[model samples]
Target: MLGLLTSIMRVFEIPMAFLQRILGIKHLAWVFLAPNLILFFLFAFLPVFLNVVYALTGGDQILLRDRAFVGADNFAVLASCDNYLDPNTCQKDLFWRAVHNTGWFIVLQVGFMIGFSLLTALVLNRDIRARGFFRSVFFFPVLLSPVVVALIWKWILQRHGLMNAGLDAIGLEPVLWMLEREWTFFWSVFLSIWAHMGFYTLILLAGLQAIPRDVYEAALMDAATPFRTFYRITLPLLMPTMLVVMVLALIKGVQTFDEVYAFSGGGPGSATTLLIQYVYETGFAGAPRLFGLASAASIMLALVLVVLTGLQLWATRKNADG
Candidate 1:
């Protein structure tokens, strides 16, 4: 039998080798990955290096025309309250405010979005009537354009709009949802959660559905309760998907801009302002824009997001392995 197997292998060797060579699968790794590598170098790495260079330079000239090499000056100004351009001392500058607001928004919006998505996914994944309709209703918001969603909410949340009209029907007074600083930030968080939860729900529902029914059956054979079966069988199996959903949500939440921009314009005294919005306002809104500062802020935001995502990935990987 061994000799016959060897003879068959020798007979097939020539044809197999020829097929492999013809397909170039021996070099398939390079062929498959070369395009992605080129794209990453061009779009990701080059922009990051350029931003770092811009952050280190001075005079707001991003093209380096007549620009001086002011090493660490921009970072120093950002760290301290001393503005190089202004003679008078500004108590709270754009940099710190943007950072603080972005941190708060990420925490609040991501928490609510993930929590709500998980609950919705759990419900939608169960054997309920009209499950498809409910799933469609839940996920429909993700199909809407962020700008359009923001505008629709803007109209609805306005003083004399649908929200207040509903409230008046119940004999309640109209609340200025976007006029005050606190409410502006609250509504921004609300809108973010509303818009983003749909995608996360779909992701988690897919994860839940992919769990093997045999595992739950085995748990039941062991006399495990429903909650125990869920905790033991469902959650452990769902770890990989949960990690992915969390990472994507974190990245998106950190880079939130469109809805906030279209709805509030970072107004009510910059209450709903985020880092990306601040970067845009600094780079393009003012008469004479501060491109250097804006680039520095953008780079900083990117670094923060990278660090957070890396931490999350590490933690999830460790949990999965265990």
Candidate 2:
């Protein structure tokens, strides 16, 4: 292994030396970066281009060559709503329903998720016993596969699962968790927050630690109340990181699928069906899959993310300027 490694290095050494002479040291960074840039272009940018292409064309065909260019009919179909507030009034009622569900999910999940994450981060930041253990315990869920996390929660929340079993053991009536509209939606948001809060909490923890100790010392010296210090100092200083978390949480909320789909299967009556699942089922899961429509839906989702990112970036920039 050592000899082969040495031989390969020897082979590359000549060209590197030759290139160094031709390009100079300054340009060598680009030479080193070329492979990664090429791979990123091919794997990342190219697929995005293809997705846009697919969205413009129409067909049930898998291949771009087989699909026919249909302009904006797919967008038209989705946008053909009599009343934006009423999904049933729209031509694509399911799409609107998914959008409605996602809006509510974002409001509940992101708000509670951020609130809990910040609280956890604040507690972890304090000088408390076994702090490291507590931090690790909180973050452990983030290391698990989303599928695994969902499956674990599913086992806990199902009608005949651990939760119901425990209830029965306690002489309490077992409720249908997944079978009801309210409970399923509640769990979906709760489960999403539970699964992902640690990652954001970790970010907020880093931000919290990065705050200069001198500032807090100064606040203490001034006899500032804890709430006043937090409101006036901690919040302003932490706004940047908090904004970043908001962007991520919003994007995650919008594009959420896979684990959510597996957990609820959009079940009972599409109660938990989200936009991403709608796109997936439309594009891949059903017969005569409407690839163009799915692509359009995805592009709209991308636009939403772009808007969200821009809004936060503006907020970040404005905060810095102020």
Per-candidate alpha-carbon RMSD to the true structure: 8.2, 2.5
Worst 10 residues of 2 by lDDT: 313-322
Q: Give TM per candidate.
A: 0.81, 0.91
Model 1 lDDT-worst window of ten: 83-92
Q: Tens digit of lDDT per residue, candidate 2, span 1-322?
A: 9999999999999999999999999999999899999999999999889988999899899898899999998999999999999999999999999999989999999999999999999999999999999999889888888899889989999989999999999999998999999899999998889989999999999989989999999999999999999998998888888988988899889888877888999876878999999999999997789999999999999899999989778877875785
Runs in model 1 lying further than 4 Å from the true structure: 1-40, 81-92, 221-225, 312-322
User: Using lDDT as the measure, which candidate wins?
Assistant: 2
- For residues 1-322, write the lDDT of model 1, one tens digit per residue: 9999999999988976776687787675765688999999999899888778877777755577666777887777766766534323444366677777888898898888888998899999989999999999988888989999899999999988899899999999899997989998999999988888989999899989888888888888899998897788888888787777877888898899998889999988878888899889887886467777777778878888888789778867875785
lDDT of 1: 0.83
Question: What lDDT would each prediction earn against the true structure?
Answer: 0.83, 0.92
Q: Pick the TM-score winner.
A: 2
Question: How much is the lDDT of residue 206 in candidate 2?
Answer: 97
